[model samples]
Target: MPPSADPSVSVTLAEIARIAGVGRAAVSNWRRRHDSFPAPVGGTDTSPQFALSQVEEWLRRQGKLDEVGGRERLWPEFEALGDRDAMGMAIAVTGARLGTAEAGHAGHAAGLLSETAPARLGTADAAVGIPVGISLSDAQRALVERAVSLARKQGAYETFDFLLGRWLDTHVRQIGVTPPPLADLMAEVAELSRDGEAGDVGTVLDPACGTGGLLLAAARRWAGSGSARTPLKILGQDIDPTQAALAAMRILLAGHLPERGDASWEVDVQAGNTLRADPHPGIRADVVLCNPPFNERDWGYEELATDTRWTYGLPPRTESELAWIQHALSRLSPGGTAVLLLPPGVASRRAGRRIRAALLRAGVLRAVVALPPGAAPPHSVALHLWVLRAPSGDGTELGRPVLLIDAADVRTEPSGGTQKTGRAAIDWPLLRKIVVSAVQTGGNGGNLPVGHVSVPLIELLDDEVDLTPARHVPKTTISTDLSLRRSWTRFGTLLHELRDLTATLSALELSTEEPAGQGTVTVGDLVRAGALTLRAGQQPADGAVRTGDAPTDSVPVLTVSDVLAGCGPSSWLPAYEVSAGEAAGTLTVTVPEEVVVVGAYRAFGAWVDTDAPTVLGPQLFVLRVDPTLLDPWFLAGCLRAPANARRAGTHTSTSSRIDVRRLQVLQVSLEEQRRYGETFRQLTAFERSLREAGAVGRELVDGLTNGLSAGRLPRDRR
Candidate 1:
């Protein structure tokens, strides 16, 4: 016996059994078979215990463990294993359950256990289509059927392993991924099956079987060893070849095919569009579950204007939503049931009104369930699940209740990127509880199966059947005004800061003064005095001029307005940056309001000097004026402040920046311009400093604070 397996050193058989969730008999059987299993050091023979590791090791070496990649695949086998059954019995039980489900219900339950098909499903075309009448090789068919049957037979334990193998074989990548885990699918299926109508399961079908996600769930519910009707003969198809392959693998796991072995399920997967081709052609099933893509265009409308799928009415060229709805209807056998996903807009959008009306008049619109947004995404718009039936063929119909379910009321934001899986991106336990309850209680436009209030049909019709969840998730007493709350916090902080800043400002007597006062010196005069150097001419680098490499620094690259008036931030500032590698001798214009100016010369903006930094095309010039006499910000603001910006542009040369000579003529009162300009200049300067300082300083301080808290850094300061 291995040292780790010495019973006294580790957990005993009783503890191990409890931990592994198995009974004493199962633990006893393991010790008898494996010689390496250890007995307790001092315990008596009759009360002797074995190490837990012994059983764990034996299970691993014996290959009792599975490598199924997903929870859905492993669930069936897990459930069966927990029941203390052998592999063959587990497979049989699971298959029997799936096969025994009410007609179309198997498809949905099966889908839960399998992968899903493409969101945009249809009769295969060239995008994925091969010639129609073409059939699969006999061997392929057998392989596919066997996979289907095995998938049907697989209990919770083997489901993961089977699904992993199937997923790899199928080459699937999830898009528009769903929420809620696989466990929820099983629970929901079980919940639904419990409400079964005595003995009336007709046939089963999934129009859109991505990987038979829903079908497997339904299959497990009905096919398991129970007091139910015969196992449902499974049928599934997908437009995507890969999805078809996956579906086949799931079915094979369920023990579906005969004699042919590995070649079983290939016949189940046809390579054609389900929508346009309808490969099943004339077949009908008792139940249809589909998660068809929403609002897609390009379904070859022009070619099939008079197609039979348009039974309700002509589908608008722009609306694929209506076409899919009608298509699902056309395939359902009379008295069959179907539950499908749809964008909530389909129920209320004007473009789909005619189709909605037709479905309504036909009485096939069984219920409109309003689900939480992101039920399936790309959009957070509330979605709807349409529960439908083809008015029971033999007059066995019940009430015409819509069962409009508004499940959005129960959701919370995800934290740490941990999204809830399936339908609504909410917690599974909660989602399962709500979904099962809704299914059972039939609340909010549902027939109460148990303990929940039922909304009347008249109530649904009241507000144009607005199946939005907000209308239903009853209002609570605590109404939180998120926006208002934020505003209050902001105002409180602002008020506190204002009081502190007022005290500080009172201490500094910063005076605004004209450099030359009422006896002012001109910007041109200052530039000429050699206090400032103009940016020299430079061509754009021969190759592509990346925005990052464009220059700045040495010469204050002033735009046209800066040359004419001054500078500041403005729309026409040249955003493409260049290094100040070499100081240019000419005035350089730039997009930045203070650093450079845009010439509103021709029509919009411009600069004057030809030798300065200029726009590549036309209507711009850079003026690198000395910042000695006039502040860059003050000058720029004076020039571009709406009225002044327009005024500066009026003095422009044709097809170029505003003429510096014409601008120089316009007298800007050193007193008035500086009066407002100084305060603006200080604010702009302070703002720039704040931005340049950025969060790095604050982050460093935060790190120091954290380090001090952790006793790594001292908090002492002078």
Candidate 2:
């Protein structure tokens, strides 16, 4: 295969592995085994690179083209284009074609020309109706055709989003990509707030729309709500010109195409700072959703000193988030809703306290929701979403209660400890439902749901006017009779469990003698001796049915979180399930005498004793031990020790990877190892008992306190 003229159009080994849907070791093996494999055309000796065109051709010849995705194949060509403006314009143009395809066949207007020659680089430029100052090669044209074909097969939305998501993922370190869950939640909040309004929401706006994520979410929500036929106008403004163009394209591609004569929806995307340059000064929108840049000091404060948007009060220099809030609020029509994602600090910051108080008095600040960290970008800190409505200036409306939702503890996992590498996984659908439901039922002076409460405006107008949801939301309330009944039942259950545990502990014969180590054997030695085998799990693909309960399918997939939490397989996605001959593919079939170890050092391992076959999720390591040679539970217990965890921590940085080969195992007979495993099991049971007892004890204290605080129980005289 002839190499491309440009050496810049090459990928790293890791990228190649991702594109090929295989392990990095597989790529290395291919390079060594095949003489026809593309030779290194660039990069250092430590990390050689191959020409993308040559590599792609070789993969096709090898019948591995099916392994590579369309987006994966097209990205190298996109990178090769090299002009940022042209690339943005090209993406937008492709998005338009996708939109046209989504709209149904519309002849030449939809770029439905014969496939005699693939659309060239200037093709999207023509579609965009502008000059992007770039030309396309024949290779680039073919790449575009492949992308369009893939989009057609995958459905336009999924394909477009996949490409956009990958692009964002690649540049996340340089420019923050708003986490999809957060963006969707913000849009849902805005949509919910528009409920029971005077008119339908036809105009949606996002002033600092980074890449039109918020607007796209809004459009999706509208489409899902039986309004697909309605034409909704979208407006976006951003500081970066390239980002602005991309945002315009995203909204255009995402819109519902007209079936008959022409498209009804109108899009206007401007490239300018919203605060410094008020591009759409006089236009008020029905809904505004924004995840503005936080802590931006140089936001042209001096130039906007006399701006009219600051109706309540001028935002301080340190409170740029407050400024974004005002800008969004100013853009909302009367009784219209706006949802803004901001740092938690903005809710209770001293500088913005007066403004918060003013907004509350005016009834513009409707709700403040505190989200858990890792819900959005800047995953290190928890953020807040402020729900606002343009004031109608009615005194009775100003007296209404404000809803506060404290979702700081709402996470897939408990937030007591630090995560090793990635942020905690989120249940986005559940989160959106919770927030929207809370907003709908809140502030009626009636009963609120758990994790939510309504505070009277009079109460919120205190000296501080602080809006921290956790501070204001009422604690889980229990009456005297109910509290006593619940506490007694819990105490009885705990006592019974304790009694059972004590009896079981008494039956175990745990040797008090110290363990004797005749020799040390590494896990690698056991593997070399054919005493054990190791393997890892595959990541579940898109559209997979993931569950938090018992699987409805034939197999149970164990996830890393399940292992970390010391539980059996509970959650499973549909992608791993096989039908007939599909079983011959990558889905793992678990056997008896297996130990599942969490890949991170923060957590350890579990010994599988289930009767049925199972599979493992991503980042979980499986050690299939020979029962006659080594006890599975014994190895798992050894791996779970703090000493071994610390040792593993030293071998890796940032994320501690388990090097099973380096793990030291005790040399002992299988029977002796079984005895040790029994002892370990007993200890684990005791630890669990202590945790349950502690939680039950806390409940008792809370019940007693709540009963007294509410004056529902008489105080005993001592």
Candidate 3:
């Protein structure tokens, strides 16, 4: 537990959580509960602490060696993993084993060392089951029990998340993504710091800091560079307390100090929402790196219509992304650079063109670097990085030259990532080198001779005022029917992947009907269970509505954009908030949503967990379960199954958008119900690794099309 003098080796509790795959409480528990837990033998408590060997030994004793086991195994195995999923699995497994041992459960831990099912978790689809206190079809009930028993044997039976088994998130796809590369953040930071005075406040900040990924990289690079990153100030803030705390812990564990430390180099993480209440509202930094929430709609548009941060244009009611852009711009001091990760639409989309024009006319726009898809949390789409400078007049730097990057043609790895993350992570090194070269070119961060044209800022004022990178960047060739060609190719693969996943879901849903089955009863019969609760939504003061068949002008509908901005029409909401007063003038209001649904999920018939005040739509059926008889979290694991999605489609009530009553008709035993939850818990972790893999894959494909030997994969059929 001793701190490291190397500085590069020192880390804190939060950072350990990110690297170790455990919560801070778990780390604290290890420090407090285990007498032999590595104690900081030397170095200041505020500095990089812990002996690597000691920590490793401790992890080993706890059965947390993670797969190949031992320090000697960490690198070779990590390097051998030829796929991104495999790499993430390895990292997670290592983190888990390290954690399992710390929790004194190492003996019960299993590893996720590879993508092949057996290489990680057992290679079998788990059984179907119902949520606690809810009934299930006879077949599903039996399956649930079987899974529960198996999961108990594995020993991890209480941590299920919905995204694991789902092939793709309907929500993520519907919302889309403009994956900004972590490399872009690094490249921009590096660009700003090139040849700058030492100890000249080399810092990076993120308003909506998620996991502190960008911050960690900057910190690590600084820490490792001897004293080049002097007094490295890395700061991050978020609206969600959990995310902020998580980021804080993560930053500390990266061998740096948290906000509690005296050194300005100490972590500067804050707990409240950044946008609504800027904690360091007046503090401008040398470099600003951020990937704010994307295309938010109804983002409290009415409330902050007159905020000062709206330097560009009044972002339309449906344009939260633009607000973030301007907000980021406001944070930069003159000569300070801001690199923002944006979605593709933000660049060329018609609606926000004027605001884009205004920003460009101001000469703040530096270089627009294009990135392949699958870079950030919502990793299914392409993204861009906009590098803007605070109009520095150091006498030489910003009068006429601005780099316009056309990186869509860069070479990529076969598995869809840049070269830096090895197997399938973002190629931060490649992109960084490219961008740094393109922007600051001849300076210390030498720019590569890119085929960029220095068009006058006035050119951006042409009728379209379009900022799309593709517009200015030349294409080597063109297929007249690009869309048609995409359709022709992806037509089959998309259909196949879709059909296969659907079949899997259907198979999971098939009921074993036998004389109405034993323990089966209608939802009305189980009204006494009280395991499900309904939160039926009400009509908004000026609500717009829509059904799947027709696209109604239903108040722009409940899009992901709305939800990310805190006002979307759905059962689930973003895990964040932007508190007022603590922030600068610009603040957004959360809009009330319309409609709600009663129990209509899988195993659990409608009417569940509705005690909290909420706004739900018919798409979400409410189910109230008996806590005494069932664990709601466990039951929810089963209810969110693919099989359930299919079953709900048919068994659910047709009126008012599917209610929960249809689910209880299927008989299920409480014993088996618990099993489904256990099984889900067993697989929940794989979600991150799986998605990371998919993200790498998506980026690889995009990068390849722009330049690759794999030929080309088809586009998604809309």
Best by lDDT: 2
lDDT of 2 by residue, 1-718 (tens): 1224455588756557766777779989999999988888865443566787777778778877553355666676666675554455456556656765654543324443222332321121122221123344565565556667777666666666666665554444445567667887787777677657624777788898888888777766653332446566677888876576567667656554343223245566777878988778888888898889989999877888888888988889999998899988898888889998888999888888999988987888888898877677666567888999887555545766788987765555322222222124555665676687788777443432336878888888888888899888765542234545765787787777778878887797767888676676887788899999977776655534233222133355667676566444554433213321134445544666577666666555545444335566676767888888988778887877777666755465536677767777788889989988887766666666666677768888877786677786656788
The order of the candidates by lDDT, greatest first, is 2, 3, 1
Candidate 3 TM-score over all chains jointly = 0.42
How do all models score by TM-score? Answer: 0.43, 0.63, 0.42
> CA lDDT, every prediction?
0.44, 0.67, 0.47
Q: Which stretches of candidate 2 lie over 4 Å from their true place?
A: 1-69, 72-90, 96-146, 149-158, 173-188, 191-195, 220-231, 256-263, 372-374, 379-382, 393-401, 407-434, 451-454, 476-718
Best by TM-score: 2
Give the TM-score ranking, best first.
Answer: 2, 1, 3
User: Where does candidate 2 clash, by residue pair?
Assistant: 545-574
**TM-score between model 1 and native:** 0.43
The number of residue pairs in model 2 that clash at the backbone is 1
- Each prediction's total of clashing residue pairs, residues at least 3 apart in sequence or on different chains, is 143, 1, 72
- For 674-703, candidate 1 gives per-residue lDDT tens digits of 665666554444443443334334544554
